[model samples]
Target: MGSGSFSISGSGSGSGSSLVLDGERGELVRAPAVRIGKKGGGKGGLLDEKAMIALRNHSEAERRRRERINSHLSVLRGMISGTDKLDKAALLAEVINHVKLLKTTATEHAKGYTIPSDTDEVTILCEPQPANTTNTSFLIRASICCDDSPELYPELKQSLQNLHARVVRAEISSLSGRVKIVFFIIPERGEGNGEMGRKILVDSVQHALRLALERVNSSMEFIPRDSLLNKRRRVSHFESSSSSS
Candidate 1:
């Protein structure tokens, strides 16, 4: 027999174990210890040439398995509160209990959840808008909320174009499956008293938003400069007649 080193067994706990990885005899030999011994010799009855090789292989495999299991247990101990004193088996049980409790709580909350109606979920309002320092124009604001759709912006632009409205400012936001758009637009220039003009501007915003809601996947409206000017003149004539009445 040649002379070399061997694994020494320590305290029964797994953590205290080092290299002696024998498992067939149901022994909890601890920490690995390097010892000066005959190269072909081993303690714990693993002496037969074939027997020693088999035991050594089996122990090494067992050690790797324990390492993996302990690694998972260590992660669980870190995540869960008060697991410092727990044994491996107890730690696993605690994790199972914790998961079950979380599932139960989530189930209870889902049972009580209420779905909102269309009216409850959305608000659309239109109003007159004050002029800004950079531009002097009759403006109106339209606020709309609807389900998120890729065609929202195109449809909104199409609707405004139908009424000859000029968009001065626009903001879009999305949250909780809904999209809200706030637009400040200048209605087509028209003949009217100040209050009459304001009313018409507000009406134009409302009409544009109504059209946007009604027309989905519609082509964008494109009005030429000359046509837009003529449309404004028509609006002015209509407002002038209404004011004179």
Candidate 2:
């Protein structure tokens, strides 16, 4: 059957009108309008004009809040590696994983284990392995106190490689003119026996550290103590301002 002409009609409905769905006629018909407000002959109704305005303002505020949350979530989604998928669940999972990794990194650096205060010297500690322990790998911890430099870490890594040792794991931390590097290493197989391996590792690491220190000392410009303190103060001030903003 062809649809008949249906018109939606209402007047002074205020905020308390019930909508009737006429399924047979396929039309929405509103109930009789009930006037509510100062002129409605009642003291006050729950759905007064003032209440409707308040409700509208609340709805608009909530919509803006949701839009802000969605914008932040979209930025996070774009940061994930596989953003082409366009799946909310996948993006959330990636964000969660990335957060876990950051937490782990923070915990690992919570304490300065290798570097000590009042020590402006390069120190290396190689733990002696007990005969009973079956693990053939060696652990070497190195701490260097020097000014911040970009090439220091790579130079140290190259030194380890020159000794024919492979780094299994490394933890590196740097702060305020101090750097600490710890390495879990294993000698290249067939290079030398156990005793020879230890000797080679010690010699190579010490020589490399001395050479690195000499290079740093020669190239570094000596700054006055007062100047260093002023530089640190400026850096701290900048950090505080940035964090506050």
Candidate 3:
């Protein structure tokens, strides 16, 4: 046999392998490259089958939400008046104003008072002083009617007084609970008799009437001022039983 030498050598078994010293490992081997097609992008890129399904689901949900919102708006538009026009923005504005008016009406009638449908219960009229008359004054006539009570005269008088109004003449009459009053008034001293004055005076009286109604509905007492107390003016009162009395 030939003489064998004790030597250290490393070699791989194939052409692709590396050589190294015996008992020592070779260089690190890299993993093979995985080839991918152009169509197969990442999760955020080209949509796969599962991503397409998810996208369709989201789109459908958004469509349903929009449909629900439109349905509600349609119902609101139907309930409001004067919305026959095709303008959506104008219709929405009308709805807002209508809602405000409804709320005011509801609050005004909260005490079981229903506004009359066929009758005029309140009237405000302003007329210029007669040309022949020497005095420069405008006549403001206001009439209000409700279920008359013994306190109605004092309430009306107090309201007029609060506005510093001078009532030239007033007539009060009642049948059952129906009380009616006609007031002929002029503005206080130094106030104008023009459109501005009339508007202010009318608004004042209207606000006072509203407050009086609230007080009456709640059974609150009306205490006349000391000046009004001494100027005791008798108001005509009528009862249904008066016919027999």
lDDT for predicted candidate 2 compared with the true structure: 0.56
Predicted structure 1: lDDT: 0.54
Which one wins by lDDT: 1 or 2?
2
lDDT tens string, model 1, 1-245? 11112455454421223444335444444433333334655553233345446656666776777778889889999999999999988999999999999999977885632222243122334453455632334445566765545566678767767765566665555544455566665544553237776666567667668667656423214323343223211101111111111
**Model 3 global lDDT (CA atoms, 0 to 1):** 0.56
Enumerate residue pairs that collide in model 3.
none
Q: How close is candidate 1 to the true structure, as a TM-score?
A: 0.35
Give the alpha-carbon lDDT of every model.
0.54, 0.56, 0.56
Cα RMSD (Å) between model 2 and the true structure?
16.4
Cα lDDT tens digits, model 3, 164-245, are 5666666565443455576676666666556786788877766776666555545524443443234333445332111111
Task: Quote the lDDT for 132 in model 1.
Answer: 60
Task: Name model 1 segments beyond 4 Å from true.
Answer: 1-138, 188-193, 217-245
Q: What's the true lDDT of residue 14 in model 3?
A: 20
Pairs that collide, model 1: 16-31, 17-30, 17-31, 17-32, 18-31, 18-32, 19-32, 191-236
Error of 1 at 91 (Å): 28
